[model samples]
Target: MIDTLLILHLNDSHSRIFPFGPWTNDNKRFYPSVIRFAYITDSLKSLYPKHLFFHAGDYSSGDFPFNTSVGKIDLKILKLLGVSAIALGNHEFDAGPDSLYNALLSENIYLLSANMDTTSHPLKTRIRPYEIFNISSKKICVLGLTTTEFNDINPYQKPIKFKDPIQIAQIYQDTFNNLNCYLKIILSHLGAYVDTLLAKSTNYHLIIGGHSHTRIDTIWKVKNSNNDTTYIVQAYEHFKVVGKILWNLTNNKLIDYKLIDVLNSPNISQYMIDTLNNIKSQIYARFGNVYDDSIKSLDNPISNSPDSIGCLDIPTGNLVADAMRFQTNADFAVIETDVLVYPLYKGKVTSDDIFQVMPYGFDNQNAYNSRIYKITMKGSDMYNVLGFAQLIRGSVPIVQVSG
Candidate 1:
């Protein structure tokens, strides 16, 4: 029997095409990453002749150019790169249904989501619960499961309801059992913990997970009811890594699998390099000469001391609370200072500085009805909330202060 090699997954690429670092002047450009991925795909196409590419969702929203384009450019890029299917992430609704509809116009890729109810919307037919692909004459069932927390993150997604992911996974598991496919893969945007639970509880052969930006370099094996093993894999955020899974199958059953990080040693193809360079030039030309002057440093430095009139290092939590109060017209506000901004210094502030400080915005009219208040809570409650706040701040860094 011939062994089939399947190159598996990608997750949470927040439209980051350029690599910026802690202290590096040269931008390594995600074009190389793209090129490398393409080269790998081409190699797999030739070697296996049966390749399945799947993304765990979050194709756009976050970076400037991709967000500004409203996922149009991303769709085109992904189409060109040959994405077979993708799960619908919360960020997919960032620009609302219209943008998603536009992005899904092409039928080349399958946009799967078992949880989202789009019957009332125009994109009803575009999103599917699952898709089946035949590779190497083997039937592979692929189902998509999105996070139920879409209600909290996506305010723009109206008339759409999110179902319980676990329930949806069970439904798909039943379907897969009936189908008796060679393999069953669940493309999930429900984060790693949920994915692990799904892998343990359900009959999925493999769980490709995303949303938490976790990079699982090793294949996590979980035992099924019959003592069979299921594989789970997830790549880190950004376009930094591409995950490859080599599945060893025997008698149409998955025996074992190995996960590889293709990004570490990418073989950049010429075509990909050329395409990346063109994109790089276009991006540089578009914004290269534009000068932004909103950011300016104050000559009079504010002290961190409570008594200081002008404090450059005001707590970000305090500033965000104040900004929220002012913006929402709320009588009182509360925020953590660490999230607001870093301390400002030197002669001139730039647009980048302002962006760094005020990355997230508040536009809630309802907040106006409420007053901003700082409450003194018990140590236990404080500890819980503070710990939660710290975790959130770590994942999504925010700067509340301007100066």
Candidate 2:
């Protein structure tokens, strides 16, 4: 008898409620709206009834609508799309572990992280290390692993120890083997490089990865210690693509595998559009009525937001510098990349959008004030500043300049 299983995967979606694009050919030009994504996933479910939908993390903390609602909208959207299980990404802890726990409690979605020690965590019982899925009577085990890089970026309220993923994976593999699982899959948010490392160290059959947000069009095959092959795949970020992996098995034995693409799924249902519009209205309701006429009717996109671009020299960075130079009339303006918190979309720019982009606080007050200082500096000192700026690269504290 022949049995088939389909695995649909998403990674690093980053709370993109709506699609914004016309990206360069070198980049993924098309990104579907939330409704479009839901429609496509629902259609896939209809076509392939025995499918498992998994997200490899970083599904939150990019869009203003998702952030303002404290991830409530993101949760609802995921629930609507029918996500099976999700791994913890570094951004999940952006609002702290308590916020993460609370946000998770609102939904019934399964959270997975195999190597994170949750003894001191507030929601220890809620996060499971792994989960088993029975696809067409074939038992498949999925173990989750989050990047230790989360600890470096965000502050957790309690001691959440993250063990070595590779080490812990070996133990999980042994356990799953004893259960007679047909295949072992690792859903990971440890980025592409670490995913490769884990594939080499463990006897798992497939790894669905995120965090680096690279568009990998091909399956990465690596030979494990036992000389068995491990396959890895990651879709491009922000709902640009849905990865569909097909399994062809005969008598519970794997025979072949292939990847299918469901691309440019742009048609959205009226119901989803109405639901998203309601969410957007609520987000706009929270705006403080601070209007800047200069930015109103600004429908032309300066560039894709930093979240979409994922690199420096973005239009948002340049906008910050221009604002500083225009307001302060400084000889030169230099603003750090981190200061621009969100990306600019291709539609009408609103006051709420400005706050999302420039949100920062110190001592319970919004402290992002535009100020100018005049001082005499030696040419050598200015050279040092410029030299230090160049040294900062790749999501570091590089300065954007304008005069």
Candidate 3:
């Protein structure tokens, strides 16, 4: 067996494929993550021919690219980065299970979710509990487990059950023992706390984790049932950092590790530069250049505050409420302050800019946007809702009203 093994891990990189921040591309920024990852991966692969690259999960949403391509380009980008496999994230089923299944199949996306039932779900027989790799005379087994929260959040993924992760992990431990793998690792989407629980119970050497977007630069060590040490690591979200690991398999010791920032790289290959440039072009070609997708210019900014229309506040939420009222001709329109994510600022407003103002509440029918509901209630019930709004009892204030 080889003395050492190298690995790179990523998680919750929610489709922010391009340089993050303003509309313009800042090549200097560590973002435009695809290129940075490409440069980094190429450098590492050349030095160490045998290595494993993994993503803990959540490569699905959180960007225009995901909405535009229905998650095809997102998967393509990961495959382009030479990712061996990805753990199934909650957001993967955001567009409904059928769409997810088709996207994964069309892109040939490999996934792992040990606790999920493959037979009940549409992705029957495709995904596995773990993957075993024989690299450089050493066999390494990698098990995967997503969180139970996935079931709670994703209503569209029906008939799918999340089994107890600890139980599943132990079952996979037996698999590793019987297969005679030299090293065992758990690629998890169950946040840091649950990962700690797994480490305490099971005998995996390493756990690369995601969910909760934790940035664990330093190794978190835990002693397992047999009192063997298990180390856990997580890279921060959105391709900001990568968990780099080098373990000495022969001695079963962690030799080196770090959470590498994408910006702190040494060299840039010409191939990576061209690939980076092409990313913008592809996005533009697929979805019209958002920069030029102008809606209209606003003479003055309309604030999206959920305050009384006659008061000092700009009543930005009222405009949405007014629109809703006019469309349905409701007696009154009521909404929450949270619905308006960004203020409609005064400027040459584009479609892209408007999307940012209310960029949430995605449903299974459309990953792009959400639908507004119109309901009927008696005056007494209406009084209760209005009272609740005025009091702001919950974390989110249910303000904004229109006649």
Candidate 4:
């Protein structure tokens, strides 16, 4: 009964539906688009009869697709991709729990969070702690864990507490005492740092993960409670790459593994193409002619990159601050580097390009831009705000200022 299972894993997709980079000539390895992601993943599944398409979390928010549709598009993509399961990500609650409930109600994918007490929330029925699947007559189980540190911004209501992930892992593993699943997995959204701690504490066959966007190109094999191998793997953000590992279900050993750069596959899903074409009209109606004639150009690329955002006033932040300050006719304008995404490269720029830069913020309509508001701040208040911003999230500049 020795069977090898292909674990096709992805995480922190963050709604990057579009592909980036020609990068190289082979074209077999581009940054990857949602369309190409579907194709490549579908191909892989066909190659392996027994497989699981696991998404760690953050299936929503970031980039154009989620910005325009507020997760509907991503949900559709996930449904089409036939995701086996996904752990809940912090971004899923960016718009609050009610919004998350509505999004989940519209999709039928299994979402899990073992430590979250959503029992009183509207999402109670939609979310669960673990799920069991019968693959080739063998029962496989997957449990989930999400990060509790949401920076005090998630607007969590009462009774919806997120418990300790490490504690929950211990408790949940014990609950499956009689099940004896062929494989036990912990799908985690607690970031690599926490995931490392979890791997050391539990004895699961694998820990597919998300949250920190850490690229575990090589599986981080840890010795768990039983002194056996517990492999941890997390793919990088967007659909740019994925990790596929062939694991022996019989011996509980990793047979082989490889990291695939998601490239545009010619054999695309026509249904997805049609769905994309349908989404185009909705986008056009929301933000008219986004890719129309370039309305502007740039001399140099302005990037508010996360790689080096240690409270430094990045060029992208500087440019956005200037625009915001000018538009509001205010004494000063401040924006966060975190809100800014993708860089504004040197060349002709379109509305769509800027959308990639800050593809968040919504109002009555899902595709609306973040409304710029003027707030009167005294000298002392400004100083305090800047001070707090500097250390809010590990010495990163949470705000960009223009005066």
Largest lDDT belongs to which candidate?
A: 4
Cα lDDT over the full model 2: 0.70
**Candidate 4: tens digits of C-alpha lDDT, residues 1-403:** 6687888888988877665432236533245467766778888899889898888998877655666767778888887787888898887765556767777888765589998864667787888899998876777899999898863544433345688999999988877656877788999999998887898988787899899888877778888988988888889888877678898877767898777876535566667667777877777776776654477877766666643644367777888899988888988888877788777766667676776677655543444556677877698888887887676665566777898
**Can you write out model 2's per-residue Cα lDDT over 147-170, one digit (the tens) per residue?**
886454444423565788899999
Candidate that scores best on TM-score: 4
Overall local distance difference test of candidate 4: 0.76
Estimate the TM-score for candidate 3.
0.78
For model 3, name the residue pairs that clash.
303-316, 304-316
Candidate 1 — what's its lDDT? 0.64
Better candidate number, 1 or 2, judged by TM-score = 2
Candidate lDDT scores, in order, read: 0.64, 0.70, 0.75, 0.76
Model 4: pairs clashing at backbone N, Cα or C within 3 Å:
none
- Give the Å shift of residue 144 in candidate 3: 1.2
* Per-candidate clashes, comma-separated: 17, 0, 2, 0
> Candidate 1, which segments miss by more than 4 Å at Cα?
22-32, 106-109, 252-263, 277-403
TM-scores, all models, native as reference: 0.72, 0.78, 0.78, 0.89
By TM-score, is 2 or 4 better? 4
Instruction: Indicate the worst ten consecutive residues by lDDT in candidate 2.
Output: 361-370
* Winner on lDDT (2 vs 3): 3
